[model samples]
Target: MTDQTIIWLVLGAISGSFINGLTGTGTALFALGFYLVALPPLQAVAIVALMSVLAGLQGLWVVRAAIRSNLPRLARFLLPALIGVPLGVGLLASIDAGTLRLAIATLLIVHGVYFGFRTTLPRFRARTPIIDGVIGFIGGLFGGAASVSGAIPSLWLSLRPWPKAKVRAVLQPFNVVVLAMTVGLLFFQGAYNERAIHALLITIPIGFVSAQAGIFVFRRIGDTTFRRLLIGLSLLMGIGIALQELF
Candidate 1:
């Protein structure tokens, strides 16, 4: 890779690690800012999928005990999401790269705008497994298509009355598994190559180090302010991505 490309990967890894550490998710949306500039949309999505696995695994490790204790709740979301992943991967392979990027940009923009002003929406009681499964399916579909699978679950849990820790416990592992499945499918389909593997090698260590720094920062701040900042940043990035791709 050229020096410029390496620089973008490093920056993306740092940004993604920070976002993942602070919020336990949204790494793909935040880091895509740099990846999309350096690689084609499809390769960017693939690389993000690999990094996302690392993020989810790290988050799960932080709450490993909680996950072990919540098996029933975990099953409520995990099973159907796995079932839905192949379908989503199928969709990914069928679309042209440009159109897929546009769709991803649109999803990011819509998610950002909605969550950024979430208080405007009426609150409702958190529902049961069926809804969770549906969200899981949607999350899987999005994950397969763009590597931002956690975005749907993250936003869904935010609307619920569940504790923040509980939300992270569920969403993080779910993202890891779903994206893991995506990566496997992509590998079988021959989406990975020497270039993607090389890029991953450069970014993974940086991701781990930056994420630890982010977790330290997260512990120091209040959740309310962090939520606002996360959503606001997502919105701005989404707008920038959409504009860059569409025009």
Candidate 2:
């Protein structure tokens, strides 16, 4: 790889690590930014998915308390996530990546904007297997297409009457499966050539180091505060991405 490309990969890994740690979206900011700066679409998706798995496994270490405390809830989310992940990956293969990116950007932008206001959407309250399957299916599609699929499921799980620990645990299994499904698809697509694989090699290790820093930092802040920060950042990034088509 050229020096410039290597730089992008390193930067991508760092930026991706920060986003997942801070926002829990796999690669909304970094992966989207790389593509905005003109990386090939297929490559962009692959890098985000690969680094996501690495960073996620890293974060998994820190979140074990959250994971272990909510065994039943984790079970509730896992089966559906696995079922949805493959369907989501299949959609990734069929749709136009650019179009999917634009659509996801638009969805995030709209949600961010609405969140900025006092307006709130109703939360999902269903506990049936069908509901989980449906949410996971749609979430998987969006996750594979745009790396931001967990938001809806997160919200849906939140509406349940469970303790917050169990509610948050709902995301772990889903994200793990999403990352795995994406990696599998990218492998079949031959997205792991020398350069992309090299990028993975360099960034994933650093990503783990950074994740520890993220945990310490997150401890100093409250979720309410972090939620506002994410919304604001996403608003600006959304406008920037949407306008990118103009340039």
Candidate 3:
């Protein structure tokens, strides 16, 4: 790799890992742009997926107790998502991926702007298993079709009144499992060639350190602050996705 490529890779790793550590989602939103500057689309995506899974493992540990306590609730979202992935992959050949991404980007922008301006964020305290499953399935579909599984779920989860750990428990594992499947799919497609492996080796260590830094911040933040962070992330992610597509 050129010096510039290595620089981009390092930046991507730091940004992606830190966000994943802090929020349990959004590695791609922050990292993919940097990766694209350094590598081709497939390789950039593969690296980000692997980075997300690896960084997310640490996040999973951060919320392990909450995850254990909410197994049933997690299942309500996860099972349908599992079912949705292959279906989405099947549709990928038929759908316009860029258009789909643009549409999702618009939804995220609108949702973020509306919720972000409110002084008291809307809280859905009641359990809604059906809605959760539907969102999860759609998120998986987006993951398979466009590699943005975390977008919808993160938007939904940020509205809940759960503690930070409890929210992270759901979002972190969900992204890890879904993105792990994505990595396997990419592996079979030969996206991880020697060049990709070399790039990964260069970036993973930096990503680990950056992730730790984010986790330190995560540990110190209040629950309400974390929720606001997610809202802000949603707006930023939306703008990022839109800019990525338009340019």
Candidate 4:
């Protein structure tokens, strides 16, 4: 690979993995743009998916207690999401992925801007299994179609009156599992050629180190700060998506 391509790959790895470490989601939102600058779309997506899963595994450990305590709640989102993925994959042939991504970006921007400035953040105190399932399903659909499984759920979970770990327990593993499946699909489709493997070998270690740094920051932040960070990330992610697509 060229030096320029290597630089972008390293940058993407550090940025994406760090975000995943801190927030348990948003690897693609932070990293994909850099990857696209250096590689083709399929290769970029493939690399991001694998990196997301690898980085997310560390996040899973950080939130292990929350995940174990809330298996039923997590399952409520995950099971439906699993079913939704195949349907989403099917829709790809018919749907314009860029249009779908743009629509999601708009929704994220609206949600972020509306809640971002509020002195009091919104919270869903009561149990809402049905809504969680729907969001998970939609997240899965986006994951399958656009490699953006975390967008919907991350937005939804940020509104919950739960601790940061609890919120991440849902978001982290959901993206990891969904994107693991996505990686498998891509593998079968021959997205992981020799070059892609070489890229992964070079960047994965850098991603791991960056993720550790992020987790360090994540552990130090208060819950309120973490929530605010999520809101800001959503807004930034929306802007990133819009620019990446429009440009």
**lDDT values for all models:** 0.73, 0.62, 0.91, 0.90
Local accuracy of candidate 4 as per-residue lDDT tens digits, 15-59: 999999999888998899899898888889999999999999998
Best by TM-score: 3
State each candidate's clash count. Answer: 0, 0, 0, 0
Clashing pairs in 4: none
What C-alpha lDDT, on a 0 to 100 scale, does residue 147 get in candidate 1?
54
Q: Candidate 4's error at 6, in angstroms?
A: 1.1
CA lDDT of 101 in candidate 2?
56
Deviation of model 4 at 81, angstroms? 0.6
User: Which pairs of residues have clashing backbones in candidate 1?
Assistant: none
lDDT of 1 by residue, 1-247 (tens): 8999999999999998877877777677668779878887667777877787887677777768878877788778888888777777678667664565566557656767876776753244666789988988887776666555665676566555544456667877887888788778777866677888888899999998888877777667654555565456556545655665677
lDDT of 4: 0.90
Model 2, residue 29: C-alpha shift (Å): 2.5
Error of 1 at 195 (Å): 2.1
Q: Better model by TM-score, 2 or 3?
A: 3
Cα error, candidate 3, residue 124 (Å): 1.2
127-197, model 2: which lDDT tens digit per residue?
Answer: 58767767777677666665666655654553355533344355655676677787887889898787666
Which pairs of residues collide in model 2? none
